[model samples]
Target: MRLSAYFMPTLKENPAEAQIVSHRLMLRSGMIRQQAAGIYAWLPLGYRVLRKIEQIVREEQDAAGAQEILMPTVQPAELWQRSGRYDDYGKEMLRFKDRHEREMLFGPTAEEMVTDICREIRSYRDLPKILYNIQWKFRDEVRPRFGVMRGREFLMKDAYSFDLDKDGARRSYEAMFRAYMRTYARLGMTAIPVKADTGPIGGDMSHEFHILAETGESAIFFDQELEEKSRAGELTVDSMNQYYAAAEEKHDADKCPVPAERLRTMRGIEVGHIFYFGTKYSEPMGAVVQGPNGETIAAEMGSYGIGVSRLVGAIIEASHDERGIIWPEAVAPFKLGLINLKSGDAACDSACEDIYRTLSEQGVEVLYDDRNERAGVKFADMDLIGLPWQLVIGPKGLAAGVVELKNRKSGEKQEVSLEAALARLTA
Candidate 1:
């Protein structure tokens, strides 16, 4: 993508309304714009990152043996009524009436709706089925703030697993647990799964995956060893559950098992959650399957959720520096930023064009800045957007038969021959 043709309307100053680093950087980088309180319209650059994150979530879900399916944003209120939660869900649910005066709602979550779907399975052979969807969800937050991190309208990946018994339900939960860990790791995040309350979903077992950040909303306490294991890529579902990890509200210091020396406390932004509610919704909604003995039994179920849109902000909160967002390679909108320092200079233009063509031909996503702008402006814009690698070309450098390669995260630069630069970038 060429910046000359791209719709990145970057701002020079921070917006007063943005209280967090992620929100401010997102606005300055021209990734998103607020349409209303707690709602935003993702601009082109932001949309590309959003899609990349969504695709990674999709791929991990599929690899975990969960089949993908599209579910409606608007759900019939009867499903909630049948599950005995219609009146209890409270104001967060956007409930209303349709043209025929029938009750409906923009689903805040899909537990009841998924349970209704599972009601079709009559035999145990259909047990252990997991289905997921990546879609928009709406919640009427009384005070929606912190940009997309707590937006009223956001994208989410929700998966529901139905099994014949409690044991089967636990196995399904474990599968999702592993999948969630892998998903976060791929996004360049170290997510710690801590024991959590089941909230309105009403589950016997629950875990919330949180990414550690200084500006995070929730305070968490956990075993210090977890961090070492996470860094070593050795975290397992069993280890996560067995270790001492809890949210602030749930952590009882007196009863904590970890010694003070091994305890680590930090603030974390919640990005994913999983629940094993067993028959909570299935029993109430009549989602039953026949057992081997021919007896009717309610399907045990679990629901897993990852905040697809909120992750964009969470990642920024965890990864950005003073300049701007430092996007992870897997979720970066583009892998390389090609800055033509002297646009229209015959030699400079030719060099940049050749480099851009070579990289693009090799299946690299490069954003070439071919605009007639000052070098400082080009550098500032590129840093604000935060591509992993940047290639700087100028008349002086071109004349010397070399181009400057920069690593955004480390702020390191090296001058290498054009051929060498291409080899390093492509490698």
Candidate 2:
């Protein structure tokens, strides 16, 4: 993609409404625009990153044996009523009536709807099934803030698992637990799963996956061993559960098991949550199947959720520096930024064009800065957008038969021959 014709509307000054680093950088980099107090319009650059994150979540869900499905954003209020939660779920759930006066709601979660679907399984042959959808959700927040992290409307990946018994449900929950760890690892993040209260979801077992950040809202108390294990890529559901981990509200300091030396406290932003609710929804909604003994039994169930759109902001909060966002390579909108320092210079333009074409041909996503702009302006914009790698072409570098390759995260640059640069980037 060439910046000359791109629709990125970057800002030079921080917006007064942006209270967080991610929000400020997102606006300055032209990734998103605020449409309301808690709603945002993802611009082209932001949308690309959003789609990339969604794809990763989809792939991980499939690998965990979950089938993909698209559920409607609007759900009938009757479903929640059948689950005995229509009145329990607070004002956060947007309730309304259709033109015909039928009670409806923009779904805040899909537990009831998914349970309704499972009601058709009359036999144990379909004992174990997992269905997931990546969709938009809404919750009428009283005071929405922190950009997409707490947006009223956002994208989420929610998966529901149905099993014949509590034991089977646990297995399904463990599978999703492992899948979540792998998903975060691939996205270049260390997510710690902490014991959490089920809240209105009404689950017997629950865990929230949080990414540690200084600006995070949740105060987390955890065993230091978990961090070491996470960094070593040795995290497992069983191993993680054995460690002492809890959010601020749930942490009881007097009852904590970890010794003073091993206990560590930090702030974290929640990015994913999983719950094994057993028959919470299934029993109430009569989602039953025949057991091996020919007796009717309610399906045991679990729900797993990942904040797909909120992750964009969470990642920025965890990874960005003073300049701008340092997007993880796996979720970066473009893998490389090709900057033509002298856009109109024959040699500079030719070098950039050649590198851009060759790298793109090799299936690399390259953002070519071919606008007729100053060198400093191009460099600043490239840093603000945060491509993983940058190829800088200038008359001086081209005259020397070389171009500069930069690592965005490390702020390191090396002058290498064009051939060498191409080989390194493609490799």
lDDT of candidate 2 over 1-427, digit per residue (tens): 9999999999999999889988898889999998887889999999999999999999999999999989999999999998889999899999999999999999999999988987988999987999999999999999998888899999999999999888899889988988888888888988888988888898888889998888788899999998777666678778886898889998999999999999999889999999998888898899999998999999999999999999999999988888888999999999999999887888887778878888889999999999998889998999999999999988888888888999999999999998998998888
What's the true lDDT of residue 52 in model 1? Answer: 98
State in Å the error of residue 143, model 1: 1.0
For each candidate, the alpha-carbon lDDT, in order, equals 0.92, 0.91
User: How many residue-pair clashes does candidate 2 contain?
Assistant: 0
Model 1 stretches astray by more than 4 angstroms: none
Which pairs, if any, clash in model 1? none
Cα lDDT of model 1 by residue, 1-427, tens digit? 8999999999999999999999999999999999998899999999999999999999999999999988899999999998889999899999999999999999999988888877889999987899998999999999999999999999999999999888888889988988888898899988888888899888889989999888889999999888777666677667786688889998999999999999999999999999988888888789998999999999888999999999999999999888898999999999999999989899889888888899999999999999999999999999999999999999998888888999999999999998898888889
**Against the true structure, what is every candidate's RMSD?**
1.2, 1.3
* TM-scores for every predicted model: 0.98, 0.97
